[model samples]
Target: MMAGTHGQLWYLGMMEENKLKTSEGTLEKARNSEEWRCQGLSTQRSCHFMAFPSFEHVITMDSLCFDSWFTPSWLDEEPARNGFAQDGNRCNDHALPPDATAFVTILRNCAKNKDLRKGTKVHDDITKMGLLEKCSDALVTMYAKCGALSKAKELLELHISRNLFSWTALISAYAQQGLGKEAVDCFEKMQRAGLSPDAVTFTSILKAYGSIGAADKGERVHDEVVHQGLLENDVMLGTALVDMYAKCGALAKARQVFQNLSSRNVITWSALITGYAQQGEAVQAYACYEQMQSEGLFPDAKTYACILKACGDMGAKDKGECIHNEISRQGLLANDFVLGTALVDMYAKCGVLVKAQQVFENLPHRDVTSWSALIEGYAQHGQGEQALKTFEQMQGGGLAPNEVTFTSILKACGALGAVAKGKQIHDEIARQGLLGSNFLLDTALVDMYAKCGALAQAQKVLDELLLRDISTWSALIMGYAQQGQCEQAVTCLEQMQQEGLFPDAVIFSSLLNACSHSGRVHDGHLYFTLLSKKYGIKPDLEHYACMVDLFGRSGHIDKAVGVIQGMPFSDNLEVWSILLGACRKWGDVNVGRWAFEHAIQFDRENTAAYLLMADLYAAVGMHNDAKSNQALRMDNEGLKMLEVVV
Candidate 1:
């Protein structure tokens, strides 16, 4: 049972980790994964990279004594007395014990290398030398940096002379592991122990607060930082504060913090920009990017990547192209796959598929995100065949599709009405046991089936979902309405309401459209009324058009005219066109001419107005009876000119 539970946890943890992995992380890991640079009197983990694989194997060295190893000359208390020069280059075969500087220099190397096997050997030597108290801080740092948190905490607790560095190692390690509550608990205990935290410690705790969305505690930390005046000199600390607030969705606080910072660097500005981008505030992000550049601070690759995201979201094609040019000038895209992916995503979103494909083809390498971006762009832009081709290429490249990849491909399938392909994807989703976890995938499946006119399959997918929201229900209801199954659409709406899901404006639009197609004038009006009354949803132009269409198609010419006159705003060309079509149907000569005149006044360019008028004359079979036949022919000539101009 324990083994099975462990397996389950591992599987879930791995999936979550993979889902959250992005372009920004793996870049530095390529350079900093194995190297650690020491810069301070107190020990510090690698600032560039945080993740380290846990080392499990333990090496026993019972035959070796504590004082049996020779160490670096710097660790020697009196190098001259030991016949070693200050900048000594010593032979390795010498027989001096490596344990004299056991507290720092040796453990620093172990932590730097993440060599737990050798670190454990040194641990035994430290214990045997009766120097555990003296060496505990470095030992704890070693364990933490080696990805052995339990051992680090065990060593930390057993030592009576623990310092701020020891506590910080554990806190930072917990933060890196995403154990925010544990990090907070450790921080409180360290404060209780009377060890004041430094800037590094504060940065780690702010990251903890951000990870868990504990903005309240983070604000308190901000107060403490302000009380200490820590932000006066440390740009990194202020950036962390801004990042914390941003991650907590407190954009105002983040902006306030950013504005208040005494010194702003590229990283500081990037932190604020990234915050806005992550919150979907693309305009703000773009504004900040412009401001950042005007300050003469060139953006780093990560900043460029983030700004690309903002451009993609806002569809700022020209700005995106300018940034792309700058990126090319810097030669940043050659080695940076993330930047390349961002470029593809930006162009894809802008509907500039040719350039997007060009950038994609020129990319040095591509990952799941890069491929997924192109696929989603293709899917959304109505290039279903291209999306399908990209998806096949991604598979041929040996990339197993994640939830996002599958969602994009499923949309492509839906757009193409490829139900057989959708079902194959559905079976794959089921076999992977991926059905119950991601709700977007759930909604996409239902939407795909509904779009393909496979209403039964769509409904079954919805029913089997562990959790159903308005979106899933909306997909099914829309499917039924679109397939002309009006009664079923109405039934689904009631069922959704019974499940305590209030209909949104979109659902009402679907309902009204269903009523229109079925010629259910009474039902359509009731829904349109309820749209404002019970639902408090303001019926937009689309809803009004549906109502007009409903009454007009049912030969209720007066009610259709009433709908047009009762509209809260000016009727758009579509509404007038529908009313004109209705007038043609019932041969209401006066109303038809009035509708046409009003429609043409609002929309002289569209040929629908002229077409509807002609249809009305032909429908009444009263070409000679109508005096406007000559005027209609003149309008037809006007339409020919309009078409040429268009």
Candidate 2:
């Protein structure tokens, strides 16, 4: 290390064993006056370095992400060196200014290493020496790179003589800090300064647009980059353009740009994969991952994480296991707790609980996310005891549960009908002030109470919620439905509509389920109609099955068949099985035959449908027909069917 006074300013550099490394540091000036007190880095302003650790003796600096060519305005502004005349002529009675180049060098080095704590001392010296005018650009670059963004912006705006590098650095920093609008504003100001942005500046601004989902603005930047022909040579810039499009959900355009790129790397592929995974396009994400590997590029940690999420989304347990093995072989799980957490979440979503637990236990470290993944798997799969035990273990390890952990624990409490435990968890959440803040926790609490058959408590919690979304109201209605209060659930539905929340497919399914259980077939039918007509919500398979169940249980076998006939898609096994059960209840042998044939066509191994049809025939005294189905079911090659009695 070297530190000494050069005029009033101190020069310092970092030294490692057998090599000199450039870093920003300064000697603490004695704070004797108010000016010094205001500029003091702190009371302990001295540099703290017992001994510099050895490195490869190769201290590299980041490339300048701005125009390398400078305008000659700086060269033409050299100060006068002669003695001053009476008519305000320039003079040089002062010997000379301390070297500006040395200060700039140290500041640039600080920016490279992000050495801000020491950089502050450098800033303090720069301010005292009145070199702010000459070193404004380097100071801004140092402050911006070191994460002191506000200070960087203030310095840039204060110095009208600022260069392109100063504005570019601030713009890049603002984008990195996720202040997209601010970064855009800074870029606009840069444009107004009559300076053209280079390739790197456009890349950073594209990231800014991506962060805020400003695809339109990003398109303009894309056009500018194209007009300048910068994309032909800069692969990094091309990747940024693709990333911006993907983040804005303009995935079609993103794919077009990605295909047009002459070269691709792991980062470009990761961006595309991340977009697909986040947008719930799991198949596309998985396909992209395979293609990236096929291009002879191995998946990085980020790519693995994205692919694992895709596998979880698709419930592809086999693929997730393959990824798990690949991750283990690469030893990526040893230090990357985030990757470890993703693995736990992947296995858990696949319903491979034992493997999830094994991965979690073997993790080198565990955070709230990893513990939440294990606990959530248990809760989701109906292993309430295991969920509760894991929750306790997480707390025992001195990790306070976050919102995600609480949500999973609440689900476990609900599944086990542990109302007391649910209430205790609710109190803990209230104490932590999580109730009004996150709607997810609110929904979880209401659902927990409702699942435990505590309708009044559930309703009370819903009423008191500071924020209520569809999921929150749906929780209360489903609770009422589960308790067989069909009328109350319907009333809640009307209330939710009055609040301007149209029912989604899930909500409609819940209502239909409640109506079916309580024998309100007409109400269920009305909701099923509104699902498509009024709400414009295309009924999914679950909704269709719900409607079938509703009609079947009410002895409306023809109406159930009508619902199946009107389905725009092909019939599933559950739909046919429900209709067959209705036929058994009503002694409708003709319809039972039709439903049994369709069910077998959809899935030859639909044992539930076979059983229902066979039972209906035997109940109707069609002993021959019952025996025929039983024999056919047994001889159906791979089908496993229970023996029937006729």
Candidate 3:
């Protein structure tokens, strides 16, 4: 009787095994059939299924066999067709698990399918069926696909019981969300939870560290990677390390790491190159690019862009042009804004404005930098009118000029001393709310007004500045000095000193020039002494020239000559000219001869010296001496003074 019961049980088990095999075979065959498609038919899977081959094959096979044979007539009656597969809940109770599994498989497909959305609904239905705990991997995967990382984490904590794929999915989700810090935190928590990181985990976290420039944290991770014996000389990790070090301004360390790379792709080379370029080390940048090509590593669009910028800074126009031709040969010219901009700036800096304008006009989209480059090009060439016209055109193009643009325009105004135009630009800058921009613009405005002989306007901008830099003070001082406003310049100088800002050589030079223009000889001498005594600023040749001019202009011929002779250094042509001019004013032959001889010796080719000596001899009625000096200048040196135009 026991043998009979055992035989009956074996027979029933065999029947169930056959049923399961038939069910699976039917699903596979239906999926593999060529008739399956997503034309006008309302099916869960379609021709788009080809993108996810695994899911497509399974869904097609299951739909063909399960939908027709086992599907309830009520599901077909309620919807036109394919309703059961579309809404997995329409499946009978026995088919629910297979349907849920199918939906999960579709969710895991990386081929970007519209059916993935339906997979989300099926996943929710699976949760309702209480199968989520039983199928933790599937639930975690579904939540990850739907971008419901919190739900994914909840399922991982509650049902996963162990993190194998769960850690990877969670880390990747964090990375995708750009929560790099959160990704690192998750990685640390995973380690605390006793999970060993895989290659994917390390790569993802390394990327996070690189993005945030967490150099110390990245180094720690690198040490852990080496300690774990997971350092496999992978190019991705090397690239990440280079990027991290580069972003951190540790170019030396970046170079060390980059050199240790056993193999480098274009990205590795490009990262190191860009790092050097950004640090203003264009020579190193180009050298690496050359080495990359020598290694037979071809450059892409990004590589070309970086190298072009390096070339521009280093003034390697030949190299830049060669790269330009290469870019054109590669047909990468259309969408390359960086390369285009770099080309414009390169040509502009090289003084090839025509070429720069051509490049600027050809750009598919002209950004602010493009216009700024062209405007600055004109400004630098002293084409102030052209620069102002370009600025107007740029504003008309619906592009508001930035600080750099305004700075260039203001500089042009200063160069031309176009006070009205400068004020208009100042008002426009204020209207655009860029008053508190860099001190460069403020300094430029002050310089413009000062050069235009508008000291009050210059002071207006000066007072509005919250904290003035040295250039601000220098601008106002130079303006007053140039206009012979000695008192005002001295006042500004005092104000500058009271602000605890020590003046440089330019300030002193401007102050001395002001003294000369205003005939403040004593004050000029006192300030020259103060430069050395109070500020330890040894008077340079310019200061000496100003002092000589001060004394010479005041008819102190002997004092001027003494000042030139008493100079710590040998007398230059400027000092002799000042003394000679003073000798002419005072009509002192004794001083004039010495000054003329010294002037000739200091500047052997100075036509002015010859002319001045001849003029002095003529003034004293020494026609013979005058004639001899003139003959020597003409015959011995082929020197001849042309008519002065200005």
Q: If scored against the real structure, what TM-score would every candidate get?
A: 0.76, 0.74, 0.60
State, as a TM-score between 0 and 1, how close model 2 is to the true structure. Answer: 0.74
Best by TM-score: 1
True lDDT of residue 129, candidate 1: 72
| Tens-digit per-residue lDDT, 54-151, candidate 1 | 11111221111111122212122222333323332232222244554644777876675565665777788788878777788899998888778999
Per-residue alpha-carbon lDDT of candidate 3 for residues 60-118, written as tens digits (9 for 90 to 100): 44322222212322212322332212334323433434554554554554112323344
Pairs with backbone N, CA or C atoms under 3 Å apart (clashes), candidate 3: 30-61, 31-61
Model 2, 518: alpha-carbon shift in Å? 2.9
Off by over 4 Å in 2: 1-103, 132-139, 153-161, 189-196, 314-331, 436-442, 464-467, 583-646
Order of models, best lDDT first? 1, 2, 3
The CA-based lDDT of model 2 is what?
A: 0.78
lDDT, residue 399, model 3: 95
Cα deviation at 66, candidate 1, in Å, is 22
- Which tens-of-lDDT digit does each residue in 1-646 have in candidate 2? 2222221111133342322232212222222321111111222222221212321111231221110111011111211111111222111211343356767886776676565654666677677887767788898998998778998988888885348888889999999889999999999988887888999999999999999999999999999898999999888999999999999999999999999988889999998998899889999999999999998999988899989999998999999999999999999998688899889989999999999999999999898889999999999999999999999999999999999999999999999999999999999999998887888889999999999999999998988876689999999999998877999998889888888887787888788899999999888888888888999999998888888889888998878888899888887888988888888899999998888888888887666677777778789997777767455464553233424345
Candidate 1 Cα misplacement greater than 4 A, ranges = 1-107, 113-199, 211-214, 624-630, 633-646
Clashing pairs in 1: 69-96, 69-97, 69-98, 70-96
